[model samples]
Every structure is written in structure tokens, then in C-alpha cells.
Target: MTPHDYLNIGAAVWLFVCWVGYARFARKRARTDHCLASVLHVYRKTWMIEMLSRQNRIADTALIASLERNVSFLASTSILIIAGFVTIMASIDKVYITITALPFANESMSPRQLQLKIVLLLMIYVYAFFTLTWAMRQYGFCSILLGAAPAHDADIGEAERRRYAISTAKIIDQAGHSYNYGLRAYYFSLAILPWFFNTWFFIVAVGVVVGVLYRREFHSTTLRALVRDLTATEAMKKSPNG
Candidate 1:
């Protein structure tokens, strides 16, 4: 098989592994106690909302903890670099094949194509790495804040407690969005790289995958509920009681 073929196979296998991981996470969540399970359930649901609408709501402490755990995996950054290397190799190999099959020497290549490939690969890496690093830093900050949160029966002032809670929630929510953006970047990088092989097929395949992912994230019941909850909260905050 060609290098592109290998990459396509690798992508499929990675996707399957991710699916299994998600399934296991779901099962583990189901087996947890009601309170903890409910918290994670909502936290997971918020990501769906963010995926669909590119917006998220700050809800509970459990959500913050869960997002922190997920971000610590650094899945996006790792995947981006790994897949980007594979794509770069595939393009290079194809170029090698072109040179070898020609009538003349196989060593020479256009500077423009080489420069373009390097630029694209570096762009993907930089985008992935920057976001991943930021997410990791924010995760650490969230962890510190979570550790410092007051106990349920603490005698802290209501305003002070509320401020802490809101700030923590916002940090976690921002982390979730950052993680999502990183994942999107990784996928887009892989999808776009195939254009060097064949533009039309890569574009169509990428479009379909993107469309499916978007619909599942945004149109799901969980996301709709979260959206409603956020809207209601905003409305209440605008009122005098809030």
C-alpha cells in the first residue's frame, strides 16, 4: 500500500480506539455513585453543547474536575504531531516516486513544493502545540482552584463564595473550548494534507466527516437542554432578583 493508504488505515484505527475509550468512560461513569455520576454526566453533556454551538456554560464543580482530567491527556497535540509526520512522509514519498519514475535524475525537486509542505506541516504543529500548552496551563490553574474551594459548610461570605465558584467554572469552560478547538485543528490538518494526494476526494471526505460530527454535537438532546439552561440563566441574571 502507498503511504497515503497507510495513513488512512491509521486514522481509522485511531478513531476506533477513541470510540472504545469513550465507551469505557461511559461505562465507568454509569457505575459511579449517583451524585458523582450525575456531575460527570452534565460535564460531558456541556462538551456536546460547545461542539455544536461553539459556546459553553459554566455549571458545576464536578464539570471543572472532569474537564481538567480530559485536558491533561493532551490528546489533540499528540495526535496532531503524529499524524502530521505521517502526512509529511506520505507527501515526500510521493514526490520521490514522481522523481524516480521520470526520464532524468530522481534527486531534484521544486523549491516551491518543498517550502509549501514544510509550511503546512509547521502550521499544523504550531497551532496544535500552542493550544495544547495553553490548555495544560489552564488545567493546572483549575486544579489549584478546585483544591482551594471551600467546603459545603464553610462560613465564607456569600459574595466571595459566588465569585470563586464563577471563576472556577469559567476557567474549566474555557479549557473545554480550548480542547475542542485543538481537536478540530488536528482533524483539519489531517484532512487537508490529503489534498496533496488528491484534492477533490479529500475535500469531500473531510466535509462529510465534519458535517456528521457537527450535527451529532449540536443537534443532540443534551446540547439543546444545555442551551436552554444557559439561556434561562442569562435571562434570570438580567432580572432584578438575579
Candidate 2:
């Protein structure tokens, strides 16, 4: 093993740390703050509240079905991607030749290095597959909850209705969180591609990926809009006629 080899391992470890650390940190913050996830959580709660007020739930059912379909599609695509990675691993000789021929690729990569890169990609996709499948299952659970939800004219008390809505919203929020995790895995997998070129490039690519994710999650215009909307909604609730 050389310096580059050690750096490659370090880069991979750092990438994994960022993924897990950010997820845990964001989950904790989302419980009380106004990050994108928290804003979405508010929206989910509002949705369930409105859903319980509606006379007909066809629209609500349609919305949940649409969400499930999206997760199912991504989960299926991840399986295909994992299969592609496995195929690439079986034909490593051709892949190595092609990669080495790239203009800026490091030509000194051993067979082991190439295999490691492919394995990293495979593992990323595998993680994505699991996340997405779990998201799909969670969505299914949400659908079941929706089906069992108290109707607009049910005899349930206001407190019970509120509790049911919050519980259902939390389940949907968890599904959304799982889907986001799967998407994050896909985003980070882009960093793995540069590993086939050089360890330094791989590290730089991981930094770029992390920066992009941070910006979108914490500083994007969308987050600002959601926060603004939430503030307005709260203000309206505090008004005398509200």
C-alpha cells in the first residue's frame, strides 16, 4: 500500500462519517428547529389535519399512493444499478482498461484498487436500495393508517383526532426521511466515481458532494420559502379572527 492507497481509505471513511453524522444531526434538529425536514414535518401535520376535516378522502388516498409509487420506482432503479455494478465487477479487465485510458485517470491503479472502487459503488447502491425499500414499506404503513383514520364525522373527540393526525404525520415524515437518505446515498455515490481516477480527486469530489448537500439542506432558497410560509401560517393563527 502507498500514500494514495491510505488516502483512498481515509476518503471513504470520511464520506461514510459525513453521511451518518449529518443524518443523525439533522434528525435531532428537525425535531425542534426549522430546517427543511422540520418544515416538511409541519406540512405533513397540516396535511393530516386537513385530511381529517375533509368529507371525502379520495384526494388523500391518491396523494399517499403517488408518494408510494415514487419510492417504489427509486427502489427498483437502485436494484438495477446494483446489478450493473455487479456486472462491472465481473468484467473488471475491460473496465480497468477503459478507466486507465481516460485522460486524467491515474494509470497506476492496481486490480485491488479498482475492485475497491467498484465495491464502494456497489455498497452505496445497496444502502440506497435498503433505504428506498424501507421507505416504500413505511409509505404502505401510512396508507394503512390513512385507511383507518377517523372520518370527518366520526364520533372521536377533538383530542383523539389530533393525536391520530400527529401519529399518522410522524409515520409519513419517517417515510420521507428514509427516501431522503436513499437520495443522499445516490448523491454521494457520484464521489465514488472519481476514486477510479485518483485518491486526491476522490477526496475533492467527496467535499464537493458534501458542500452541495449542505447548501441544499440548510441554506437553499427552498428552505427560506418554507420557513417564510410557516411563519405566515403561525402569524395567521395568532390573529384575532384566525
Please report the candidate that would top lDDT against the real structure.
2
lDDT of 2 by residue, 201-226 (tens): 87888788878887888789999998
Q: What is the lDDT of residue 2 in candidate 1?
A: 60
Alpha-carbon RMSD to native, per candidate: 13.3, 1.3
Candidate 2, position 100, lDDT? 90
Worst 10 residues of 1 by lDDT: 48-57
Displacement of the residue 77 alpha carbon in candidate 1, Å: 5.1
Q: Using Cα atoms with residue i matched to residue i, what is each candidate's TM-score against the true structure? A: 0.53, 0.95
Q: Distance from true position, residue 35, model 2, in Å?
A: 0.7
Candidate 1 C-alpha lDDT tens digits along 117-202:
44565666577667776887787787676556666556778677666666666776566556766666666656655444444545
Off by over 4 Å in 1: 1-69, 75-95, 98-115, 221-242
